[model samples]
Target: MCGLRKVTLREPYPDSRPKMRGTVTGGADAPVRACDVRFGSADRPQFRLKTIQESALAGAFGQTVLKQGIEIRDGQGRPMDGSSSPTVAALRAKCADGPAVFIAEDRDPNSKHTFVRQIFASYVEAEAERLDCEPLHFRMATRM
Candidate 1:
């Protein structure tokens, strides 16, 4: 099954200056806010997947937010194919409970290497806390 492996956060883009601690700027497409959270390095490149809409995540926890639901996407920025893979199925099942934080190996479709994506529902932050890792909050610039 494709699962998430431990990963270290990417360093800030060379062009932009670092903002508040754990915050960086100028890495993602305009309008989408992103923050890089550092994780431990692994043999493969690992990525953290989060929804662009914070409200959707807040709503998942029963908090009031403008958005109502979460949308999961693949590395290619497409809707996930849950039915075709056990990894996706497990991820989907975990997400059903609430907002989820996933740590996954970034894969190239053209490559033959296989990897897994790990899903954590609320538990991720707790795990991070246990590991003494601070979760980085990146505020992506919104497109007008």
Candidate 2:
């Protein structure tokens, strides 16, 4: 194997919090829409649940119309914002110049409901094309 422990199963972090996106700007002819994808389960389940939920959501919302990508970066394409999460920090350290989509899937232990919040960067279209997912319905959920 690649010595990589897949995050297939994870204990819900008690303090799991919602994430926010940074500033972004897209080129001409692009529609910026905020796509809020949320989900969660009551019982402790497998990681595939996330994938399943994502797939179903993509189906309902139409993947082609909802696919979105985001790249977390500092001003001037630098990595590591003062408010970046550990996931973001590690990503930057690994690939400084790489673009990253910061996805937050939050599961509430008591309610068993998960909230999937997606933050799309202004460059989501290009990135989504690279990933072959789909162009996202862009929106500003968090005010930067």
Candidate 3:
């Protein structure tokens, strides 16, 4: 038995990653997301309660559609004028060329407002860092 070695049930393999990782991305096309990572247990229960409330409201025809309720703001905390093309063009340049933060004039205007706030948040956050996530990469690259 001098040459024999025993393996235990809980021995972790050297190449295996732990259950948690330091960095993750919330890619739109992937099921794994940054929401799966967070600062605390804060959002989980709040989300469950919100889901229950939304479920109840669903039967009551839900809330009215938000029109003209969203405001776009800048780094100085002032509202951006959506009607000004020149101002928007400047924002596009400042946003590190992330997804068009504007409701593109060429794309259909329907339902796109639903995503406007979130897109701008990512746009601004990336702008501050001067980077964005793409696939497995943390750097921006020229489109193929």
Candidate 4:
């Protein structure tokens, strides 16, 4: 378990003097001192999603629907085609109403699979279904 240690200043330093102007609110015996304290991280440290993954997630989804150029008359009274590219329909079909899926493919810098990929699908039936509104099987490559 992680815990913090109490710090106290025993006496005033040669250059620094205690300003004992007012009495202690709790009582006289209570120690009132200031000292520098440091804290470290606990065990089982969790990591954050890299910046590339985050950017790719938002950018990829945004670019998919925007490609069809077909206006969605639902929200904002304007076009709702905010998908980043054609792959948006396939992604939405696979995940259904489920959370977005982020797959990390480890590859060399020169290899093709060395990037973060995100796909959304709606798995309501037996297998993941691709939304049929448009054919969005395109991919948007994100730069490292």
Candidate 5:
């Protein structure tokens, strides 16, 4: 019932000109190109666990285990625990084996539900895969 979708984050400027390909030097008023931004909900265990009750993947592996935020396990399926606040570096160290599943909360503050956003095959490609759904890629623009 779940599907992947493409999302774009844009930074708008009323007074800016588009830049040509390979033209590094442009007028100061040139519109800045956007940068791609990618991340998974499971990137932060605390937040993931905090919002677990409101997630659809509640019955994914084990409800009890998931409720406790122990989705990242070892080869034998033992929960890995450390800091309540985990960083990208911490996740990379824990997910050294392969992809890991984590639910991502929707950006909409008013939404009452969250979905399984990404399945990371590795730390480098944080949003590489998905669970019971299609893959989604997001293009985000930033100011230069």
Candidate 6:
């Protein structure tokens, strides 16, 4: 089982202090006060896609067509594309009719999976049923 505990410490050093209000694993942790350190996975050599047996690039992470051949556009009437992450309110305000695909995209440059692309492409392919029209990714894969 896992639980979170509140930890408050008083230190006479800085004007601002940080409390260790995080998950407890019953392990020793460095006493941090007003420390601005963010933990993240180390930059690993871009993993191999071959391991997953998938390689489909979005020649451009922009734009999808509706069933009626209408291109998905942002509130500005611009064709939705690029690494843009729009909010639900934005979509609701723009797409008044229907079929407002959220288009979840993970712009993580290190991850080795094209899961986002797969979802977007598969959805577009299934809904639009237009193979030739499915948009492509803008970036190129690593050189062989």
RMSD of each: 14.4, 14.4, 19.4, 22.7, 16.6, 19.6
Winner by lDDT between candidate 4 and candidate 2: 2
Q: How many backbone clashes does candidate 4 have?
A: 23
What C-alpha lDDT, on a 0 to 100 scale, does residue 1 get in candidate 1?
A: 8
- Write candidate 4's Cα lDDT for 1-144 as tens digits: 001122122222223332212222333222221112112332321111111112224345544333443222322343333332222222222232332322112222332432122221111111212212332233333322
Worst ten in a row by lDDT for model 5: 82-91
Residue 88's lDDT in candidate 5: 16
In angstroms, the error of model 4 at 96 is 3.2
Off by over 4 Å in 5: 1-68, 81-105, 110-144
Index of the highest-TM-score prediction? 1
Q: Which candidate number would show the highest lDDT if scored against the true structure?
A: 1
Local accuracy of candidate 1 as per-residue lDDT tens digits, 27-81: 3222123233222333332322333222254334321121122333444555431
lDDT of 1 at 94: 31
- lDDT by residue (tens digit), candidate 5, 44-110: 2221211112122322434333333223443454443211111111111222223233332223333
- Which of 1 and 6 is the better model by TM-score? 1
- State TM-scores per candidate: 0.24, 0.20, 0.22, 0.18, 0.21, 0.21
Query: Model 1, 47: alpha-carbon shift in Å?
Result: 6.6
Error of 2 at 126 (Å): 22
- TM-score, candidate 3, is 0.22
Kindly provide the TM-score of model 1 when superposed on the true structure, using C-alpha atoms.
0.24
What's the CA error at residue 107 for candidate 5, in Å?
A: 3.1
Candidate with more favorable, higher lDDT: 1 or 6: 1
Candidate with more favorable, higher lDDT: 3 or 4: 4
Candidate 2, residues 1-144: lDDT per residue as tens digits? 001122121234324331322222342222221222223432432111111112323334322222333333443454331122211111111112222232333333433322222222332333344334433334322322
**Model 6 poorest 10 in a row by lDDT:** 46-55
